[model samples]
Target: MNKRTDIISDHVISALGDGSEENFKKLLNNRSGITFHKSGKYSDNTLPLGAIEEELISQRVNGNRLPEGYTRFEKLCILSISEALKGIDIDITSEDTLLVLSTTKGNIDLIENPEMHHKLDLWYSANRIASYFRTKNTPKVISNACISGVSALLYAQWHLKEGNYNHAVVVGADIISKFVVSGFESFMSLSPDICKPFDMRRDGLTLGEAAATIVLSTERKGRVGIVKGATANDANHISGPSRTGEGLYQAIKHTLDDDRQIDFISAHGTATPYNDDMESKAFKRSGLESTTVNGFKAYVGHTLGAAGIVEVIYSVWSMYENMIIKTFGYDEFGVAEKINIADRNIKKELKNVLKTASGFGGCNAAILLKKNE
Candidate 1:
């Protein structure tokens, strides 16, 4: 028998907005958060990014009444979790509940600050966040690069299935800072304008800041259930995706669990030359090329650790509305592999949706979801 997990409540703090309802509305209206800003970090040059506005960030912390000593990333994490648990009946302090945090670089900017360097460990961040809820067990932190969010969710699924924890809250977050921006700049992997996923003329990806949370419980009270999930690492290359898409293919194939038909695919369309191509190859190999595929990176920019969790929440939104979100900047087919890309809003009965994410270090994770009917 397969263990079942339900996504009870979700919240997202992103460039688009705070709550999932607001963000989904904006997405349905074809709104984007990518913007241009003059930066002093990268040689005083103007860079187009998907950063959350300063005003929104300020309001989020102030409105939430977060602790005064918390850092920006900490405030974002706590705000997202608090919002997600708003009306849920789960007792956060119960020993039956678990907390999992997904982040690629926790306080990466602090590395440059001599005083902050002493507290940059990811475990420290996770412990601090969990302390707010007074959980019985120390929160688990997953730091598996860009796919960390999906990995964390998968871990929670297995943890709940193990008959140990009745409920698990998974949160992922990453913020754009000079430390992360300069590293991507060094690789010239950033797009100059809004990213165009699967577009023939696509240049590169744009980074965004976001924190998203999803609460999973073994009980079937939520509107969506996690059907299954899996992860695969081909180790094809240390910092590059497998050109053959083997890693991503295995991840998706396992998640499908013998179900050949998926209503839609929420892909990790980073808009880079190689990443998009690899995803197309994977989808085609998995016989999902005919499914309407959409990428959220164009709307929110590649939000690193938060990408998977935020996109999964958006996929649930699609299921809730029976609508397929248009690939924000996908204009024309550009990949060598032929795959159906959603360029316009699609109104259809969505039953099964697959969420996939791929990051540096050849890591790929995938999970399946079904609308709770």
Candidate 2:
């Protein structure tokens, strides 16, 4: 058997709140961080979004242990990574350890500060984060659109299975900026209100920003086990999912292997019309149509690069706690195909889980995790 990799620690900073405990509590109560703003940033027009309150963001950044010269994005990433590393014994400076950073846009917001925008270079941002930890190896960065987080996890999994690395610290982050907001606006995909992932009235996604970090170690034994994962692209379109859901279906199918059973699914549920429908079709083809599924987008909005990691961490928490959280904004049946979108939280002995994500470039990825027992 391949070496087993487990997530020993996780830290998520989103509109949902600071850490896993807080985020989990708010998720169960169906709290949403999305709010409407009639002024400042993005555009002068009224815009509803999922955003970390300015006060909270400032507090977290100001409290960051890292020194100054770090951008807000860097501060968020450092705070999350520091949170995950707290009380953990592994030396990040050891060569047996590696860092994998994931983000669709790192400091893209820095464009407003051209003197500092040079730091927006993803590789440079990664090195800064790594060097902050004094990690000895060149940090690996993944920028493969929205699936970047999951891809980083799988990369860590591969390294562990190769019997070379003892531990991997994976951090995914992205801050919403005028650039991203305007771009999504151009696509007409921003929700005017909190997004409803699989609801009949759902219109579009609410943009969100967050930095989430997890400590993955083959050295630790925990209930959260990284089993297997796969990625595939249907080459359907640059921005739209395949109507047949071929790529996503294949990714889920391969990840499930012969098991054909998972206690639940953490769906990509961007709430965009095509995304939700495509996922429904994919679930159907993968024979998981009846499986209970939920999306966290309504709670934290879609954190782009951080979405997959934060959702998976939430799933791990669900597995350990045996509590399935309700879909925050789901009210009515919405998808063209039949799939069980959890209308309410269900308490079940969740021994296994499946997580999925799809993004631009027609890419899709799936990951399966099981309780360590």
For candidate 1, write residues 1-373 as lDDT tens digits.
Answer: 3667999999998889879998999889989988887868543557877777778778877787777877778778898999998998998789989999999998887787899975688888888899877888889999889899999999998999998899999999998888888888888888888899999989999889899999999974788899888889867987777888999999998888678879999999999999999999999999998999999998888899889899999999999999999999888889969999999999989999999999988899999999877
lDDT of 1 at 196: 93
TM-score of each: 0.97, 0.97
Task: State each model's CA lDDT, in order.
Answer: 0.89, 0.88
Candidate 1 pairs with clashing backbones: none
User: Any runs in candidate 2 off by more than 4 Å, and if so which?
Assistant: 62-64
lDDT of 1 at 165: 91
Error of 2 at 227 (Å): 0.1
lDDT of model 1 at position 339: 94
Give per-candidate clash totals: 0, 0
